[model samples]
Target: MEESDIVKDIEKKTRLTSLKKYMWGPNILNLTLIIMVSQQQFLGRLSLLSTVLLLISIALNGITLIFFSKEIRYEENQQGIHKPFNKLTIRLLIFIIIFFGAITIGYFIR
Candidate 1:
């Protein structure tokens, strides 16, 4: 194939890879978090409402991952997962990292 054709092929493959990650990547992380939380004992007492909220959040995360996989798979014929990352996604990811980092620091400090 010509140089232009090769470039196009690479672009196509990269897009496919991105879509695959988008579809399946979150589930892996989500499952890992679930496992860690389930295994590790939480120190101190938590209120019933807090526990319920936590369970709800976990369920929502699982559901979201499932829907994400379905949507990504459904777009198999498309060029790629073309979903635009808006403010909410960006903030959510940032907050997730920051929140986890804070928790880790607190764990160590205690």
Candidate 2:
């Protein structure tokens, strides 16, 4: 392969790695929020601070997903793959939306 092709390969790998790293934060936060919200009796209550954090987490996850999706599309186009709808993308979006909706309901009810 040409040097240019090698450099592009490295760039693509780096971009994918960075995308995964960007996802890690929100994924961990989502898991933590799920656990905390599930334990109502153990925790006994939710605070305003927690509610705010939940909202922030949702927004962060969404922003990261948007960026990741764009990068994926760009990379796929570069690779000559025309798939626009990835199952994993759809699944993650649905999961986050449901999680956000549930948290919003909890925030209001609490």
Candidate 3:
């Protein structure tokens, strides 16, 4: 089989351009928490470690998304699977919200 055929097969089977599928999980989780934080009731109910994971996930995902967005923007002027600036801005906003929320909860819990 040709190299291009192999790549096409992989892309078709995975339904994501390898990079995207890998990054999607964490980004989606971060977005989930971003939504969670907006709901007042879920704030203190989750365990501290869980909260920590959520915070870290948001941070890492935000950073990853930023890089991903920048790369996408540089690659093509037209839109592809994702919009670079929108994804970056949303992830960043989510990270900020989660950071402040986590700090506020930590103080109250302590």
Candidate 4:
């Protein structure tokens, strides 16, 4: 039961590494969501297809965020030191919240 063995086991069980290709999932989904919303504004019409895509993208992003959060806690625990979150992360979280709220309002407005 070496420390390295424990860390490796944890990683294997969780299947989460911040450096993995899927780490881009959240960013890509976020971009897609914004594009879907913006297209409606420019075209000036309700699009059921865009709405369905937006919901799917948001759900996928939510799953990605859960993995990201788990990885953050896993790394922090392994380091034995709890660090404050990055300013950029905080700003991005805020931006996501505001945009999500706007989307909710837009969904109801139309």
Candidate 5:
């Protein structure tokens, strides 16, 4: 490969790395929420602050998914692949939705 090609490849990898770093914020938030939910007493309810945190976490997760999906689509397009739904992406989406639903239900039932 030419020097220019090597430079371009390095730049692309750096961009992807930066994007992945952006994703970690939401991933950590989701994990924290999961831990908190698990520790709650069976009969206890989410407080208003916890509900708000859940909402923020869900929104952050959604945004991360959107950024990741766009990156996957771009890569697929560049490689001439036609995968419409990546399994990991689908799992993340489902998990976020389930978490959001659980929190919403908990808020209402409190």
Candidate 6:
């Protein structure tokens, strides 16, 4: 590919990466916080419905993360450097596991 072609493609991939990071990082955190506070303050902790909602949100985010990582890895294959993406995937996997575990614990504990 020409240099300009590669530049545009790189821009596309970087934009995808930024969107994925925002959705999973701060967006999920903010959503969970909102759900938790709404349940606590509005519902008076009277139900597990909010935890269920949080679990659904996390599951959807995990699926999106997986797909985004796959797309990014495809974009990076031309450069033959996969270590950084692998580390990111691993970290995301860990985050997914922890969130699922914590939500499960919160559901049962409460």
Which candidate leads the pack in lDDT? 2
Model 2, residue 99: C-alpha shift (Å)? 2.8
Each candidate: what lDDT? 0.53, 0.69, 0.61, 0.63, 0.67, 0.61
Per-residue lDDT tens digits for candidate 4, residues 1-110, read: 45697777676545535434465767676766755664565646567776767766776776676667666657656656466766346745765785677577557656
**Clash tally, candidates in order:** 0, 0, 0, 0, 0, 0
Between candidates 3 and 4, the TM-score winner = 4
Local lDDT at 48 for model 6: 68
- Flag regions of model 5 displaced more than 4 Å: 1-3, 37-39, 42-46, 79-85, 104-110
What is candidate 3's lDDT per residue for 1-110, written digit by digit as tens? Answer: 45696776565445435546566776677767755544435454666676667667667777777776666554433324445456657756766777687557554654
Off by more than 4 A, model 4: 1-22, 43-46, 85-96, 108-110
Q: Where does candidate 5 have its weakest 10-residue lDDT segment?
A: 34-43
Q: Write the per-residue lDDT of candidate 6 for residues 1-110, one digit (tens) a residue.
A: 55697787788778666755655674466456445633454545635676667666666766766666676566567545566437556858686667756665555555
Give the per-residue lDDT of model 5 (tens digit) for 29-71: 7766754554455646677787677667766776776777688
| lDDT per residue as tens, model 1, 63-95 | 665565554554544544455544335545754
Instruction: Output the better candidate (1/3) by TM-score.
Output: 3
Tell me which of candidates 2 and 5 scores higher on lDDT.
Answer: 2
What CA RMSD would you report for each candidate? 11.2, 3.4, 5.6, 5.0, 3.9, 4.6
Compared with the true structure, the alpha-carbon lDDT of candidate 6 equals: 0.61
| Residue 96 lDDT in candidate 3 | 79
The regions of model 1 sitting more than 4 angstroms off are: 1-15, 23-25, 32-42, 77-110
Q: In model 1, what lDDT does residue 25 have?
A: 60
Model 3 residue runs over 4 Å out of place are 1-27, 37-44, 77-110
- Best candidate, TM-score-wise? 2
Clashing pairs in 5: none
Candidate 6 backbone collisions, by pair: none
User: If scored against the real structure, what TM-score would every candidate get?
Assistant: 0.41, 0.64, 0.48, 0.55, 0.59, 0.58
